[model samples]
Target chain A: MTINPYHDKRLQWVAYAIFFALLALVPILLDDAFLLNQLSTFGVYGILALSLSLCWGFGGILNLGQGIAFGLGAYGMAMTMQMQSQDIDTNPIPPFMLNNALESLPMIWEPFWNTGTGIFLAVAIPTLYCLIFGALMFQARVSGPFFAIMTLAMLSAFYTVFIDLQPYTNGVNGISPPMPLEVGSLVVDPYSTTSYWIVYAVLLLSTVVAKLLTQSKFGLIVRAQNNDPERVRFLGYNVAVYETLIYAISGCMAALAGMCFTFLTQYVSPSQFDVGFSISIVIWAAIGGRGSLLWAIMGAFIVQGAQSYLGDEFLNTWILILGFFFILVVRFLPGGLAGLVELILGKLPNMSKQQKSPGEKPVDKASLKEA
Target chain B: MAGVLEIQNLQKNFDAVKVINDFSMDVIELTLCCLVGPNGAGKTTTMDLITGRQKPTSGSVTFRGHVITGENEQMIARRGLGRKFQIPAVFRELTVRQNLEVAYSHEVNALKNIFSFSSRQCDARIDEVAEQVGLQERLAVIAGTLSHGETQWLEIGMVLMQDPALLLLDEPVAGMTEQEIEKTADILNTMKKTKTLIVVEHDMGFVREIADIVTVMHMGSLLAQGTIQEIETNQQVRDVYLGTEDH
Candidate 1:
């Protein structure tokens, strides 16, 4: 029988179906709550990795402050849940405020205690931050190393501010919400396996939404802008607007991931938003392939799963390995593992039609010389 | 027709070096003008000043009677002026069809872009433009994979999709083959029927074929402006071209 290389959509679907089937069986087979929780953590990381991919991969934005946005969302939910447990009006100050502090809670922290306000702020704060950052950087035509430095500086600034604001943020110790969330008569025991499933559902929905957006016309513009901003601008596009929009969207998605993270850990701390987390998320995207959304999720899973199995003794060493992996992929495998898979598949004897010709060369040598 | 582009004493300086000094030009209706000069003769700077890519040190540029002296690049572009860079700027990862679609200005929102639909008008127009540029066969091909000549054509096709009133092209056929150069001349010739075009190039052969009038520049100042034959025999032009040879 002749193999139809053009009809590989079936193979693609089957691969995804098998992967999900394996994931669904994990909770049933392992039965170990700790393992299940680790898997849930991986799901949160996957969401974050996917979000970063949208900005960095598609938009060509080297955002190093993604963890700050994620922390904002996680802390936003944690604060609201804390207020709910204390029987206080979900206002700025809980009724138990007198016990912890002599005066009122800060005004900015007030909106975060209400559930609706908390959810809104979870997505809003990061989006606003990214919008402002993007507006300044893109308008100034900052790119390459300058763009990377600006993002790193922003990340460092957010980290320092969170660490210094001990009174409101609870400083390095971080804030943890109580178990079994009680909102009015409703109690949500997040420790239950059902809560884990809910988090998974959110992850799947957000992934689908992100996938749709990446394939859309706006996504096309973002990708184009990445390759050539000047051309997009010449086409009468406000390149800054597109960059800002992508930043905001990625920020909101990161924030949503943080919300899911808070439900899993019931904690929000400065350490969670540190530069280390930011680097780890980037590593996830890089390992997956810079521009491929599916690869980003896979990268998160592979990295987090390996870390969980290997324990903390191997965790520090993992960073070194990841750094080497990044260098290797950037140098040898420009497309990462997914790109490698495609290459290997193309080389298969039966997949001749799907293969790209080997002799193809770059077209604009003179343009590069002029630049 | 009313003056679509009017420049008054446009001057630009880089540190102590004056790149464009007291440069002035007026473009009326659908006319093709070529700006020719030696390397570092401020041809690119002149185009930059008109397109709002580089702000002039001192000068005024009016487009469509609107004083666009200090407008931003995007605003200037939106005001019915299109620019094609000397470098063939294109989205390498996208297909030719997708590149044109993104360049088409039907929807401009960033948030709603993902759910937006391309109109049938957009598809038909893309096809028409691609066909005009002889790139219809390569519509599905990735733009980065195109030949140098093809990429230049694609960039021009992208600009054509915008359907601007004024077009600024810098060395549109810099590295193209002779045949490709002929095709580019034909494309520009066809476009001049409906659009005012200002092209900056060093290839006198190509310029002479398509230019309605040629402007010559030396040391950042306009040396002469007239038909190609008029400027070629001008004493000062001959002196400048010959004087540099003795050095």
Candidate 2:
């Protein structure tokens, strides 16, 4: 029997609703401050995974320097909060500036003092960096594994720069506001319910935005490029522009997630831009299912939750266990958790058929079965 | 009829191996021209050069009396040059309707494309292209699930959606069944009224069926250009191309 395509679409939306509903229940069930903080981290990382899914999963551009965007966002917001804590009458200089024995406030740090400017810079900085980087790289036709390597190198460079600039950036220790986040008169504590709600709101909004983007014409074109970029070019789409735009969007989303992370954790650090963290972000997306944004986000939550559990009980062996699981998932369920669900539900077509891309020889079903 | 596409002395070399050597052709408006050549005769490369998929070492490609030589593939496509690859290059994961929808150029703005999608008018256009390609019933089917012949037709439909002035097809009916080939021929024949087509094919019979004029190439150079009968009767073409086919 032919499945109604609309029914499948409805079913997907239902899955999304259930996922969101479960996320909503997390706060209600966990009254503990530590658990709420942990849950907030999961929410933030979910957005990060979603960002990766948008770039690598759909656009076929692997950005291993995603943390650079995230770090920039966190720092942008952190600087604003730090400047906010400055006394207008007695002492204008922030604690970090005074600690560095700066005679005057740095002109470079002035713009981020405004809440609006800080938020704008948080999103704009990464978006602009990605646009410039993507324009140069894609124009040169540097993509796939080469792009990944370039991004990784750039991330390492960004980390070193952050570390070397100790006076300005606070070096390896990172930037943290001395006071709570203040919106006009209300003080938003990092561990408070209000802070948790802020992260949740952004997470929910990002999820919806991501869903809409992937369903749009632009998303289809990006996915099309992933399969055959030359074909997209022949179809009247500037593949480089599409790839660049998607990469930039991913960067912006990563920035937003980073801002959320800073709001929850009350800190920003150079360690976030490390190559290992970038790889971990990729793993979250890989584990969930890069093919779908929602799956990627869920994958982040699942992996992080597992990490917390493993870290609490078996700190040393958690890494080993996760590594084993990653290998199994990569080998057996290449599509990740979402793909496994898709398989069980018979949503996907024959594996061999789906694998048989243009110009590729189709695998023999008989041989596959026998093997 | 006026010439819609003119390729003059097009030369392309991959390192030392010359793919298209001083190849030239004038494709008249609203004509189905078949490009027939042996296995490494640079027929596809010629199409690539014209469509701007591959940059020529030395050549000039003029579309409607304007020099489009060395233009990017997307730029050439925007100039009304639509090309279908040797492999069925439809977005396999997308539905048949979506395949045509993406090919349609109603909303060219990438940013706007992200927000507001194609209008209801595009649906009607997609239906028309689907009908033309005989994939109307398979509109809901994913391109990946379609048979090889259907995938070929879906790609042809995608090209039609663009309403291109010049359509270059590379081995469109390569692995099609006889029925599918006849259907494709019918589709091409219908399109011939409004579009200029340069179809590269190995099947001489299919060429004879749809081609108004045929060009035969050998060793990256034009060997013959004439009617199907003229090509079959030409002694040089027979010796270089059809002569070896008996084996």
Candidate 3:
């Protein structure tokens, strides 16, 4: 079989080169720390959208509660940072633990004291959660718009749980480390160049991971099932297993994004757990053209950059503008921005000349059958 | 040796309507069996039951001696049972060769399917299946872009890629040109020498071209089982299925 056109290696590498080159240009152009921090935030959002695209766009699973995994990862990072801030001896307790008047650290909080374990939990917890949750839902054959609602419902439940668990979660106010991250001899100042580079590295790593997955044999089945799952099943594929594995993988990506987001923002709040955040993640992917990884990442940057720029002056109007813009995009560019580019490339004379033969006869079956 | 397929006292009911009632049939190995019947005769339903798309109301479907009545479709399919739908259900977005590669059942493990790339042997086998179905030229073309006849061949090629022991094809050549029909008949005729196939078709000419054993069904039950010529002369099959023009 010829290589899938979607996985065109040369085009993918060029896109990657352009993306990283643009990212490299960012720090050089913008020397201001605040602006650099904002760019880093957008980078985190790009990872989030990329993760959503993997599941919803490529895998054909609309997980409206992707924020649940994101929120969990963020919480994991925030909790670890907070545990690091606490004294180990006379008052060996996290400040949030003191908020609920606890003298001793909880057993769960002990694991986050080590930054390595904390990072592991950040990615691992959400991955495990998705494995269990996705297995149950997919095995039960829950999918489509119904699957979306189920995920949203689950997000609401997790939100409630996070809010009610005041001792562990710090209630609705959430958890933020009182001090800059200090691991023995090294102190990671949240606003330092080190923090920016760390977040940047993580974002790049997340993108690479996502790219490898979508290009793998597993990714082939994902795209196939996205078209027709019944056909895949009849071909002897375990549809549930395929969906579950992809869902969990997607969750891991989101968790990585969340960990970086928490590191950049230095806080995890209840707002991150909202269903709207998850939906917004989906919209970001849609804006970029969910079908392509690079486009989805760029989509997040464009949409979030616009939101941040206009958000101050227009406040409430900013959201309405985004909604209107998304509607316009859906109407005008069904394949998103990347699809529009593909459409333009398809129309060019040279491309058109080469495509005319195969394009004219074979794809005309619908009209032919009508006659 | 026992028959490759043995369906004993098989019954299927959808809600209150009994579609297949007390149907029993056995086809020996490497046979091209054509099942002919009018509408609502449970011809497709029997295929579905054998392929585990539907649960039998009663009785067992034995493939190679193992009872596989209520197993899931994927499980049955992995056990070398392949089926082509009445409507050509192919991965429309994928290329024709990719369709065969996806259905190629050598590496059926879910984990292996994800991490592993298609082997050279798999590619060679796919090419062979494509050539067999006269789709070698259209291998790189997207399946959805293929003509109706081509899509039908692609689906058949997909089933053939698995090298299934028992293949259930529903209307193998319903909407094909005369040339395409002849090619399809030639393909099926060659395939039956090595594989067992039960084809359900309304096209009598295509059936006569390929069928060695013809079984006639009427009202969810078998009416007659014999050589195509024998069934053509059977009064009961002629009255219930074929009109009197066939002498």
Candidate 4:
């Protein structure tokens, strides 16, 4: 069987190269630290959208409270950064802990004292949380909107638990580390060009790797599971396992983005646990065209950047503008930005790798009966 | 030798309605058995019970000497039982070849096959299955864009890819034209040497062409069972199932 035209590998790789090359040019052209930092944070948002697009779009597992995982990742990094600011020979206490009148660093906060383990845990905790949560949901046969609501419920749980844990979580103030993360001699200054490029480079790599994955044989089954899960199950696949596996991966990616957010922003706040943040991540995927990873990332950049830039205005018209785009996207652009691109590409001559045979009509019954 | 399939006094109830009642049947290897019954005759439900889609209220389903009753669909299928639904259940967004590739796999482990590409052996097998189902040319075509008849054939093709010993096909030719139906019949007839298939159909003409053994059900109970000629002439079967051959 010939490779389908939609998954033309060479074309896809070339597109990725072009997209990232253009994005990488941004840091070179400008030296403004504040602007660069904001753009890097937006890159983190793109990564979050990319994660959701994979799980919900290709993998067909919708998560409504993905922000909880992001919040966890942020905290994972924040914990380490906080410990970095501490003098272990002296007090070794975070500002949040000081405010709460804690005499000693809690036992649970010990691991975060090391920067390396903290980075690893930043991705790991959320990944494990999702692996466990998704396994439970899929095994119990909870899916569709029920799965969505269940995840939202989990997000509510995280919000409540984190906000109530005055000692560990700082009770809603979250953690703002006094200094940047220091791994030996290197300090990961949030506003530096190096940090901006790191975020940019990671997003680029993530997009390409995730794109390759969605095009692989595993991706084939993921799409199959998305389209007809029962059919996939009867064909000898553990449909729940597939969904759970991908959900964990999505969790890992979001957590990575959250880790990067800590590196870019120098802080983790309760706002990461906000339901609207998670919903916004979903919205970015929806508007960007959840079907295509690149488009979804673009959607995140466009919507999040616009909201950021325009939200600063006194009028606060950004929400209305975002609502309009959301309506336009959902009402007509069902495939999101990717669908629009495909529609245009399908119209252009020589756009597709394979051309239809001349006068070869679809093999409908009428034609076969006529024959 | 053990039969390919054994359903011992299987019963399924949805709430208060007994969908399948005390139904028992044994299928030998390589038999193209047709289950013909009217609408809501429990033909589909029996398939469901055998494939682990529905949990039987009582009794057991054994396949190839293994007790598969109450096992999940994934596990049952892994035990070499493949199935097709009444409506074509192929992955719509994927190409015909991709759908076949998914079913043709022996790699059931998700992590093992994540980075794996289509092997030469896998591609050759997919091509062979595509040709068998008259979809060799349409392998690259998106399943969603395929015609109704083509989709049915695609589902059958998917089942064949698993290379299962027994296949449960529910109304395999429900929405096909005469020529398409004939083509489908040819495909099923060709698989009789290595595969055991239990097809549920309403069309007498299609059943007459493909069935080696016919089991007739009426209102969730077995009405009659015999060869085509014996079943066609059976007065009881005629009264409930063959009463109107035009179906």
Candidate 5:
């Protein structure tokens, strides 16, 4: 058996176990209901960031429309919850329908009322969208800048469609939960801390699954495809199929995260799935390092945690700071925090000796070229 | 058992320039045919046409007595035709073993590939090919980190894993140390026992070492076809190759 040092399955499982344990203890350590709620939201964002990493990092696809998939999932769950709350016999519609002069709920929104159907739609819709989009783009061999532009176009189009479909989607005002969910005499409030922790637990499990997928044989293909897709194709593998699979998987993951987000916020609005959210997910993946799933989740938690703790004071400057950070990290720290950690660990012995040297000569350009 | 490759009136044109004008060749089973030509001779394009990478203007590429002219690359590959690009085209991010495993993945069956059982036989074959290519020691090393010579070997190893009846290698040893080139020649010689090998290479010394027959191409047409010494002495072949005395 050939021993591969780069990917160790046992080490990965151990790491995931540690992560799960730590997340399970968050409610215990924090103890504050509001902080726990924020943590739950952070968990949702972490899942989104991890999904973005899987697509962009491993698959070499720049998905600028991830928020669109998330919105689909969130709205799917929200619409179903809203319809169930209304308790209308034939066509269960929200009160907003009467105000808009609509007599009954649309036929399309009926499937979402059932929990199984809602969850299925939450995964299926985004996956189907990505499958169609990926097939078209990959078959056309649209990559790099063209791929980015195409995804951005899709994001804007989805945003417009969501904002325009007022009768079904409620437009920009979005949809909110009418009441707490009652599952066979069990009442579960979305706003409750216990409910938030449940969402957090789901996030942790999803992240673990994502991490495992990355380390599998399928994951290796994805990583290799990103580095040199032509080579993968020449190896008798279908490069387009690999890309499409990852794209759909990433879309499903984003949708799952959005489902959690609906529970945390109890609302699904157009603004939540706008370009801002899409770009923010990219930022999280970038700060975490594109290669590692753990780093991406950490990047999400740190960035969101800082934003939440800093409050409204830093809200105005957050975008600017994030933009600058993106530029700085891409320029100086190519691997983000993960790369920095590796560098620091590498120089542990020389750190004390080189403490006095403030600035050294720049790294050799030729060596960088070789890498 | 039959004609491994039969190209009948293969025609290809790039806009106005007519490259590969009515080119044809017949390669029998288990024969090592070396394709030698100067730059722009369309040797690579010939392999591309055979492997279904590029559609010919007018031609028929029959592999194992079956027409595969317009079949997709993956489909052609699954039909026991493996190709190596001019550049070493191995998955750089993956280890040598992982690269071979992916190359040896199950055939493209729409439904079977979705829910296929892992093939232990394929794993054994990968190990066998790794040993053949002298990459057994470097099986765990990332292909991107390998030396240029090792990368070429890794590419050849990937092709070997496909278990193809006919192998098309393009510039298999373009940039290699003398020892590495010699090793590649030895591997090719060993490979010719079971597979029909068509090598497009410029290294005449290496070509002379393993090729059973030499086919000299000039400006996208066959200049000469014979044994190594026969082509080496042919006046027309000399004129096309600039009469390089190294061979």
Candidate 6:
């Protein structure tokens, strides 16, 4: 039971259940395996968008290099998956490593052979990186556009280093041609229903976790921090800690999404960590409605679906079309698709109702008018 | 009696200018002290120094037998000192009750606040504060949608939710109707019974109603300190501040 009438938790859950159920039905109803597999990729993209939404909308952090975390996750998974394919007992070093004149299998590549370790590193590496990086930025009291630019600059540096480590990383070519992921004895093929289910389950799980977090008492402080960080600090909150933690959480989600992407596509490349890919993730969140997680998910699906459909037809003008679309959304609908929902909900009976604002004055309307 | 709060030889300078110099004041437990000054008398700056918003160039602020110097606002606030701004500083998007809940959840460290909190105690505290500030009916109303007076009361309620031992208020009744000011005076008067209060107010009439002690500042230093009647008659206070005012 909720104390406030404004957010009826039961009603929200009902709506949430219905949406996820419909999403679950997509693979069952669609006969085309190819389209269903593509849908799974879109779901993974949606997770990336949701991560950005939480950071930008809820935490008021603008990370221009969100792909850094996503790329880390992708590379972690790719490295692990690549190791899974080789007969490591006899031929531990991959062909690329040998080609680069490596004397021995590097100690860093050893643990990634285990899927659990790979996934663990995939999530943990980005989270720890962000936690340390966030603490530095926030403790120094850097925020807004400056924070955004710093993150972007960091991604450029990270990308340069990642490219330079050619022997371990495979450089520009990236990690590819992995065997199907094995869990115990069960082989999870890229196109398999098990893989789709894995992505589906995680997307839903993370969304709920995100929802619970943003609705918690901690969330209350975070929102308060966003409104007036100084006031919240004076109210006795360590806002730097709050901001840093949220940033770290967002990074974890992005990396998780990246890991899922690698599982579905069986490939992870430097392109995933590029500036363009990071910007695309932001555009999806903004287009979908950064304020609402569900809308952000839909934003990814719609944009990726449109891109696939239009990329073949309008290969030259696709970027310009997307730019115009972004401009229109920003100009006409500042809140994106989620704002439209709020506007509509406002008109519906009992939907947007809260206590009459300006408050219940003891003075009557006549007295107020006279005053 | 040992002062509940003490400020001694406090100084704050901006480049070449001394905003507050040798500012000294002691607030006894459970007493209301109003700081009155002319526009450039450094009233606001003194509040900043006490609250640790700005570290003093040289001085000490002792609260509850502890010298809190060069500490940040969050740490100082956690030491049981609450502050209210001249403008209503309540979170605009949150409901009145949520704002109170946030203020009541005073642990401030995110890790402790993450998964769980004392909601049962917090909710009770919220209701109590909402009632105290006469916002019981508007608990669910968004703070941004409040009228100017209501917003001020909400901020007061938020500060009260934490139940700090000392409260620092800056212009608690700025831009209010006559009745709102009276209500605010009543709230401050009530608070002084259980908590020490440091109020910076330009409204002389309001100060006269609730101030247990009046400290007048002139040119970044204390000109006079005494009861309202004493401050009114003091030749120095009249010359520096009272004489120039609408009083």
Computed on C-alphas against the true complex, the DockQ of each candidate is 0.55, 0.49, 0.56, 0.65, 0.40, 0.54
- Kindly report the docking quality category of candidate 2: medium
lDDT of 4 by residue, A181-269 (tens): 77778777888888887788778777866887787778888888888788888888888888898899888888889988987878787
lDDT string for model 2 (A1-371, tens) is 24443324444555577667777887788888887888888889999999999899889898899999998888888887887888656777877767888877778787877877877887899889999999999998898999999999999999999999888888898888888767778677777777788888888887777777777889878888887887888888888888899999899889988887887777889998989899989899989888777878888999999888767798888878888888998999877887775564353345433232111111222324655
Per-residue lDDT tens digits of candidate 1, residues A1-371? 23333223344334444455666776677777766777888888988998998899888888787887898888777877776655444444543444457377777766755777777777787778888888998888897668878887888887788778766777777777765555556555566576567667767776667666776778888888899888787777888888888888888888888887887788788876788889889888887776767677788998787777764777578668768888998898876666665676566675455443111111112222554
Point to the candidate with the largest DockQ.
4
Report the Cα lDDT for residue A357, model 6.
12
lDDT by candidate, in order shown: 0.78, 0.83, 0.83, 0.84, 0.78, 0.84
Error of 1 at A74 (Å): 1.1
TM-score of predicted structure 6: 0.94
Alpha-carbon runs more than 4 Å astray in model 4: A1-4, A349-371
Per residue, candidate 4 scores C-alpha lDDT tens digits across B1-247 of 4588999999988899999999999998888999988888999889989998889999999887889997999899999998989988888877787888898758888897788876888899988998899899998888899999999998898888898889889998997999999999999999887888899998988989999999999999999998999999999888876777653
- Deviating ranges (above 4 Å) for candidate 1: A1-32, A89-100, A182-186, A312-316, A353-371, B242-247
Q: List the residue pairs that clash in candidate 5.
A: none
Error of 5 at B127 (Å): 3.2
Name the runs in model 2 displaced over 4 angstroms.
A1-11, A28-30, A347-371, B15-17
TM-score values for chain B across all models? 0.94, 0.97, 0.96, 0.97, 0.95, 0.97
Poorest 10 consecutive residues by lDDT, candidate 4 chain B: B238-247
Pairs clashing within candidate 6: none
Q: Is the docking of candidate 4 incorrect, acceptable, medium or high quality?
A: medium
lDDT of 2 by residue, B59-170 (tens): 8999999899889888889989888889889888777777888888655667888895447888899888888888889887878999999999888888988889989999
Judging by lDDT, tell me the better candidate of 3 and 5: 3
Poorest stretch of ten by lDDT in candidate 1 chain A:
A357-366
Ranking by TM-score: 6, 4, 3, 2, 5, 1
1 versus 6: better TM-score goes to: 6
In model 2, pairs of residues that clash are none
User: Where does the lowest 10-residue lDDT sum fall in candidate 4 chain A?
Assistant: A356-365
